[model samples]
Target: MHLLHDRGRPLPAPVPVPRDAAGARRLAAVYAPPPDRVHVRAMMNTTVDGAVSGADGISGSLRNPDDSFAFGVLRALADVILVGARTVREEDYRRPQGRADLLEPSRRPGGGPRPALAILTRTGLLPRTIEPDWPTYLLVPRASREAVVAAGIVPADQVLAADAPADAVARLAEMGHRAIQAEGGPGALGQLVAAGVVDELCFSLTHRTVGGSSSRVLDGPAHEQDWHLASLIVGERATLTRYTRA
Candidate 1:
């Protein structure tokens, strides 16, 4: 991994990223949220031609080592991981942390709780990948909470009532979260984009292109918004770009 540009200025040369702990800390600083307020960061991976996944219809097929590095760093900096239920099903999201050993040291003081995973769903139906041991939070409507829990699927304590993506974000913020990471399956990304609460987009592009039937990064009603490039880094296997809402 190497940083090519920052704050709209091109660096004279690329800086090689080391495979040590120092490198992880440096990368974490770049993705860290602004301190005084709640921030929503949307992270996504796409092919050069704008497909979010490969022929098999999962984003995993599009991931490479360099891309995974950036993704892990972003996850490490977040207070919560937000995604739609469909994304959980498709991605087989099983754990709160990935590559924990490669993350920056002392990210949380004295072995703090792992970043919470929040899934946005109307039906409250979860994939089997979500285990009983792994704590989870579900954002759904208030009226359905009782039945959803009565099904013995998830605990009542784990469910948070949210009618929409914006509401889910607000609830998360109220829970003292200042950094929210939105990892999407297109529909969820679109909802957050439409909600107008996204502060930064950590969009990544792999070196290869997948001309499959995969959808673009955002999927929903057409809407337009302006953004300014904040940082651009070119890695050995992917190009990572961060855009701030204008």
Candidate 2:
């Protein structure tokens, strides 16, 4: 299928939510995108220099209560959270949670809404610990039908093919998901960036540095041009940077 860029219609300009403590208290509203729009947002915490992980191979180091709350604000506004299976399993995500207005009973606390938890994996390997009762979607390679069936989760209509990353984003838009928030493993976020599918990047720059030979943003296929950056906010100990495809 030919990729649908522009989707033949103009989408409304994104509304900006003011940064405040009260805004953090509010249950972020869900984004309802038009059927044809493919809106993607990536959320990641990086060191002062931009390493997603440390030399110890631990990513949990990149979390703070303030940063976590900021992430909740973004999650409350999202229709769904799209993450790579490696991140999911490695993170050992059990259940998702949400606060007052954002609460969807189906998901765990601080986990945001029942908006589907979408995972991208080529091997289709999923942890048996997670119950099939929750809302989840798996995007896997076309060749992994058997594994998908074994997992007993419904595979999306568009399975990632040889061009898995490209197909994944296209399928996401087709499935009526307007805003996709990519929670990372670096490679997955890079894939979305390379495909030009990402719309906004809500980056949390922490105060520390993990100097190592690890991945930085956009480590996937090389882009001929640089991405556009906007809305630079400098916090007390952290900075929030937003980016869009130029």
Candidate 3:
């Protein structure tokens, strides 16, 4: 990754990252969260023109190797992944597995497990194609718990009821998940931003521009927040930027 802008420290010069153990550790350090307490960061990919998806209505078309590498590193460092129900369905979300080499060493000595999945859904609706073995927390409205359970989307033990976005995030922090990352579906991200719970945003900007009616990275009612550029890493086909909430 090329160092374009960095306010923290002088980063190493850009180099082609090999798909190996050492490369994974190096990438994780590029955006590692502070270990003191829970930090909520949003990770999203967008085109140069600010479209979140292409004509196919999916964000995969805009991805490149560097972005995929960064994605895995972020997931490996996170304690739990927060996502919206729509993103889970559209992205075919499943239990993260087979990356023990990347995720295991990041865990605390007695930590419960490596990165659990927590989905936010007000209607308690989930995709039918979700894997049964993939454990997840269905954060639903307190009143909708019964309806969600009846839908058989997930096991009863994994259901978590919350009144608002802040509540769910707070609960996760209480459960010792301090390094949190939200892989969003815009609406959920907007809620977190509106609630003033987001601490940072990691955006991968692809070089291509797909002009259409596709949503921006964060979508919701008009709510403005200030962010400061923390770092910018230029990749071969995309640029990875980290913005901390001001």
Each candidate structure's count of clashing pairs? 0, 9, 0
Better of 1 and 3 by TM-score: 1
What is the lDDT of every predicted structure here? 0.79, 0.61, 0.79
- Scored by lDDT, the top model is 1
Which residue pairs of candidate 2 clash? Answer: 96-108, 96-111, 97-108, 97-109, 97-110, 97-111, 97-112, 98-110, 98-111
lDDT score of residue 192 within candidate 1: 89
Task: Compute the lDDT for candidate 2.
Answer: 0.61
Model 1: per-residue Cα lDDT at residue 172:
84
Q: Report the lDDT of model 3 for residue 241.
A: 88
Give the CA lDDT, 0 to 100, for residue 140 in model 3.
88
Positional deviation of residue 222's Cα in model 1 after best superposition, in angstroms: 1.5
Tell me how candidate 3 scores on lDDT.
0.79
Using all chains and alpha carbons, the TM-scores for the candidates as numbered come to: 0.92, 0.75, 0.90
Q: Of the pair 2 and 3, which is ahead by lDDT? A: 3
Superposed Cα RMSD, model 3: 2.3
Give stretches of model 1 more than 4 Å off: 98-112
Task: Rate residue 242 of model 1 by lDDT.
Answer: 95
- As for lDDT, the candidate ahead, 1 or 3, is 1
Query: What's the ranking of the predictions by lDDT, best on top?
Result: 1, 3, 2
Q: Give a tens-digit lDDT track for model 1, residues 1-246.
A: 888777767879986665456776777766667766788999999988999988888899999987888888777777778998998988898675744763445353212356778888888788877875665778889888777777666677778888877788888877766778899979989988988989898888999877857898999768899998888888878999999999
